[model samples]
Target: MDLTDTVAVVTGASSGIGEATAKALAREGCSVVLVARREDRLERIADEIESDRTLVIPTDVTDEDEVTAMVEETREVFGCLDILVNNAGVLRVDPVAEADMADFREQVEVNLLGAMNTTHAALPVMLESEHADIVTVSSVNARHPAKEGSAYTATKYGVNGFCRSLRKEMADEQVRVTIVMPGPVDSEMRDWENWEGRALEPTDVAESIAFAVSRPEHVEIPEITVSTTDKLR
Candidate 1:
């Protein structure tokens, strides 16, 4: 799983952990494909990397066509895909009893269906590589749910289940699948006023992804849970 010369497709690359992971992968000598709806932000990240090896694909993962195009475009530019990072997600916090159904549907679209769409499209390309890795960014809430976070929890749990099933299917192919669960992160998704001093930084989760991708081919770290030392919920 040496990242050098590898091609990684990262979703939600415009911000948060995906952004950091893209930069980290670039630093490790891996060619990166940045996918998100924000072309301008993707361009900014591409410019920061300053590498001709990067590809920016403005994609909304919820769309099947866009997800397929993302993988096709990555293969077109990089010639192969070695890694797929399913980091695109959305969070809506409200009790099911009082929550708007539309909000829940939106979360499911981006968080669960989005991961499925991208992973399904990326699998064939990954199978063509010598070694491949699928890293999914889940949440601690998937395992330990909170009262008001039902929809978000359901989507993360869906991601966890999807990754596990995908890993079993790829077991014979030697394609590694890893799930990372972070408690909370101070990112664009969070409100700074309420976050205060709590929560892990997006870079912390990004580093964990880097570590997983840098491991030996024989080593498959399936799941890693990370949280701020003080924020034990």
Candidate 2:
């Protein structure tokens, strides 16, 4: 699990947790691939990292074809895949009875299915590495439901289930699966500026993710729940 010279792909690299993760991994000397729908933003983030070790591949995780191609390009360019950070997600706040079906569907597609698409496409390449890690960014909502956020919570719950199942299935394999759940974060997806309690910064979660993957090979950190001390229950 020495991140030095290892290859890592981070989705949703355009902003927030993904951006911080890309920087954090780079600091650990891992080569990073940035994937997001915004090519321009990716380019900007790329400039802040070690250019020699950074690759920007604009991708829509919801599209299986695009995700598959992204993995292929990563392997072709980097020669191996050691880490995958499935951080791409969207949030829609609304009650089920009054919710827009389209919004709910998009949330499911981007938050749940997007992780599946990336995982499916990256598995084969990741297996070749001596040790690999798949870190998915889930939410506390997966375990605790939220008002006007049932649709969003549903998607997180689905992803949590998928990751847990995959973790058991891959237990004997070299790949390690870890789920990172953050209580509330000030990110592009949500505005926590007015919250009465403290909110986690993206780097806080990034460090948690980095810590998860940097553990000794035999020590598995299956899940991490990060929340502000004053967070509302």
Per-residue lDDT over 1-233 for candidate 1, one digit per residue giving the tens place of the 0 to 100 score = 55789999999999999999999999999999999999999999999999999999999999999899889988988899998999998877776899999999999999999999998999988999999999999998888876688888899999999999988998899689999998778887763233344788888999999999889988999999988877544
Q: What is the per-residue lDDT of model 2 for residues 77-122, given as tens digits with 9 covering 90 to 100?
A: 9999999999999987766899999999999999999999999999
Top lDDT model: 2
In the predicted model 2, the residue pairs found to clash are none
lDDT (Cα) of model 1: 0.89
Which candidate has the top score in TM-score? 2
Residue 161 shift from truth in candidate 2, angstroms: 0.5
Q: Could you tell me every candidate's TM-score relative to the true structure?
A: 0.96, 0.97
Residue-pair clashes per candidate: 0, 0
User: What lDDT does the true structure give each of the candidates?
Assistant: 0.89, 0.93
Q: Runs in model 2 with CA error above 4 Å?
A: 191-195
The parts of candidate 1 lying over 4 Å away from their true place are: 191-197
